[model samples]
Target chain A: MSDHVVSRRRLLRTGLGTIAASTVAGCKVLDGLSAPDHRLRHFMERANDLTMAMQRGVLDRDALAQEFAPVDIRQPQRPNGVTDPQDADYVAHRNARFANYRLEVGGLVHRPLSLSLADLRQMPTRRQITRHDCVEGWSCIAEWAGVPLWHVLDRAMVHTSARYVLFHCFDTIERSLSGAIRYYETIDLVDARHPQTLLAWGMNGAPLPVPNGAPLRVRVERQLGYKMAKYVRAIELVDDFSGIGRGRGGYWEDRGYEWYAGI
Target chain B: MSRNTPPGPLVRRHTRVTRVTHWIWALSLFFLLLTGLQIFNAHPVLYWGDQSGFGFDNTVLRIGAVDDRGVVELFGWRAGGMGVLGYSGGAVRAFPPWATIPSGTDLATGRVIHFFFAWVFVVTLLVWAVGALLSGHLVRDLVMDRHHWRGLARDVRDHVRGRFRHAARYGPLQRLSYGLVLFVLFPMMILTGLAMSPGVNAALPWLSEGLGGRQSARTLHFVLAAGLLGFFVVHMVMVVLAGPLNEMRAIVTGWYRADAQEAGDV
Candidate 1:
């Protein structure tokens, strides 16, 4: 027999042998990987990484989300998650109509900022009508007005070591048996520097409503609605999100959703 | 008793590439459907136009239920429409656990399964397209000719009447169904799927726009998936009607027993 035929037969034999072995031990293998404390499956991580890489490699860094005409804003944006936070501090701020509310921006920065709503509005601003796509299979278009996040990062003199921007929110999505936990989200520096990444405080020519994250919210336009942390309380620059909330980068992400929910 | 029956020789029907790709497509599609439904159950309501949520009058379909004390709530809609989807007494379940992967509301697991199989489905489709082109299977087997057009009505009628003749080549109705699936439905599914991705939206903004918007694209994706499911059901029925063992063997082993009457075509 020719060498090619011999090698082909050998390869097929080995392949079949491996398949048989795996099939025999399939239940055990699955059980081990599916243990409660197991890390995210390698295949899931690989898929997410591949998607992230493909998006970053193919698209321009500054590519914008599709902007809509004013007429396209047909319906009011729906409030998801905790619309009204009942926490003591949040309640105090709400009673004052957020007069005492100060957005603290610190961590890995030369100048930390404690900016109020009035302070934020005075800065250079952009208004664009864009669609907010939820992971739950719905969308809404509304005009958002806010200062670009990068401009704030620049004013704060973000250190070169800073790789991510994390948002701390006022709403508590759940108070589980473990403990009370607040909502938080994070984005990489690339998204942080995007022009559409805004600290939005206004919607559709009016101040944001309590149901829709009044006072402030982060708008990473190229991401799904979950990434846009609402009822913003603070912004912190970090080298990594390993120490943040179960180390999964965001609230929903820690609970099983993909961190990079670009879809 | 007759003693002069002739044995027919086995003929090559499906190519090795065709068989492998066909199975891959079948497996991936199965997983995709289960996982896609799991994802859909996260938000069972579908809408049209630009936006949809509470206070939006844009719901095209909803799957919900009524509770004790006649409090009807279809995932937030206070209405009563129960024949197709909603139920009474039991908890409101859009698609039951049996229909979903993980058999629970695990969007993360659903997404992972969906995405992994999506790559498998797309890659297999591309490979099949290339193989079909090179093997002339696209032209010789799938495409209908002028003669086929003339006999299309008769072929459809015969199909409906259960008067199918065992033939070496596919009939016009088969070609038409396969052609529509291969060309129109699959491509629409892929495009609509991509349009829902914000990453893909950045890469190709026009894709989402052409489909009306991300939400509209999502609606289209569900609609097309349902179309594919319909095709699958019909395909399965046809397979059983046409002879399950023979059809299965032809797809699996790439060999089929030629009909004695259709020997002339071969």
Candidate 2:
């Protein structure tokens, strides 16, 4: 090998060596060893600088997103995040083509009920064209049609004590210690009651594709793309977001991302 | 070696002004990163964070003012920070405190500060760029020769293996990072930033075209900031490996002491 190759090989070996050591150490004392604080701080400082620049001159905060004609919605709207459901229950639901799919709505409601996809589709619906602004710096526009979330809550008779609506997704983002398949997101009642908040079953005027949250998903127009959780299975009414994933209130929340991805 | 030849320790690398501007650049870069992330509270990078509310405008409305929406609305197209979005006065008032642009906080203020500091950054950068041209810093310190390009692999290995600190000057990682910061990041910030100006935007619409439009100028700014954040992380990591105090002192004082003496003079 050339000197460069040898040196690089040595460096890669050393990096792997550190990773191995840290992995072993992680098994023993996973909590105490805060990785050296340097990188995160540096990352933070850079994030701050970018904010100052944009805040100062570059951005138009009120700039409206490009609105599209009503007829231009794309067929087969894309599915975001995890495309395939790995959990056995989700797999079963997918296999059965969601024939038995039902959304259990409970918690802080006077009349909690398990409504099937058929039941959901039979209700009154609304359609809106909006843009999906991804945190990864991409945007796509689509028209979503679905049953208004408030209408569903009304049928279930959500109690006055309820303040937030939590959507339990069918996808297992991370396995919890209790061995229960954990999946869910929460939105406050103000947004929950917005006319645009819907349990969408169709995208671009067609039956929602399997990849694009086939049976059901949410369309929270005001928030960024991630907040519109896909493969939704249940909607739980709650008073607070506490006891939710790290209390930041979403799956990605536990992983150091923000909870409210509102644009 | 001839007796009359100056030792490696005596060589002058970066000038004083160049070093000072670099430090300022570093500090401003860091502050921008933190506040930017916090402001992007689309995901609320932290608790109590909100997207679009931490700017100066939002900060001013928190002083117990009631029914100021009319005044806010009256400010009109040129008021607050950005222009109006046609929301009813109720929605305008309902905007969380963080979204209100202070009376003095307009794109103009941002432009003045950005243009002013940017000129400072640019003038210093120009001097450095000229220095690079004169000294062949781009050819020698930056654009690695084809033969040395192959050495990058081993340099990365040595860097990861902890032998990089022993190498003279910055290692391959440091050199590449510095090169990108100076060449890529700085230029992008300047160009995209200038593209946001209406005068500049009209004169050269294509400049902002890559980033969608002038409205997206902020988004591009944030994207570039993200790149800088990545550079900062790697930069600090290398500094830690190289020994922070010694490295910092060398950059600050323009003199490497320690083994910088005759101990391992190349």
Q: Please give the DockQ score of every candidate, comma-separated.
A: 0.38, 0.01
Which 10-residue window of candidate 2 chain B scores lowest in summed lDDT? B43-52
Give per-residue lDDT, candidate 1, residue A227.
Answer: 95
Candidate 1 ranges beyond 4 A from true positions: A1-41, B1-7, B53-56, B68-84, B264-266
Tens digit of lDDT per residue, candidate 1, span B1-266? Answer: 11112424567888888899987988788778877987887887777665675665666667765552232343345765443244432545566555667565677777876887887788888999999999988899899999889989998887676665455677788889999998898889899998988878876899988987777788889889999999999998877666655576678778766566665664
lDDT of 2 by residue, A123-204 (tens): 9988777655554333455788899898999999999999889999888666678765465778778668867788999888
Chain B TM-scores, listed for every candidate in order, come to 0.88, 0.62
**Which candidate number maximizes lDDT?**
1
Scored against the true structure, residue A176 in model 2 reaches a CA lDDT of 72
Clashing pairs in 1: none
Which candidate leads the pack in DockQ?
Answer: 1
* CA deviation > 4 Å runs, candidate 2: A1-67, A70-76, A176-181, B1-28, B31-266
Candidate 2: TM of chain A?
0.72
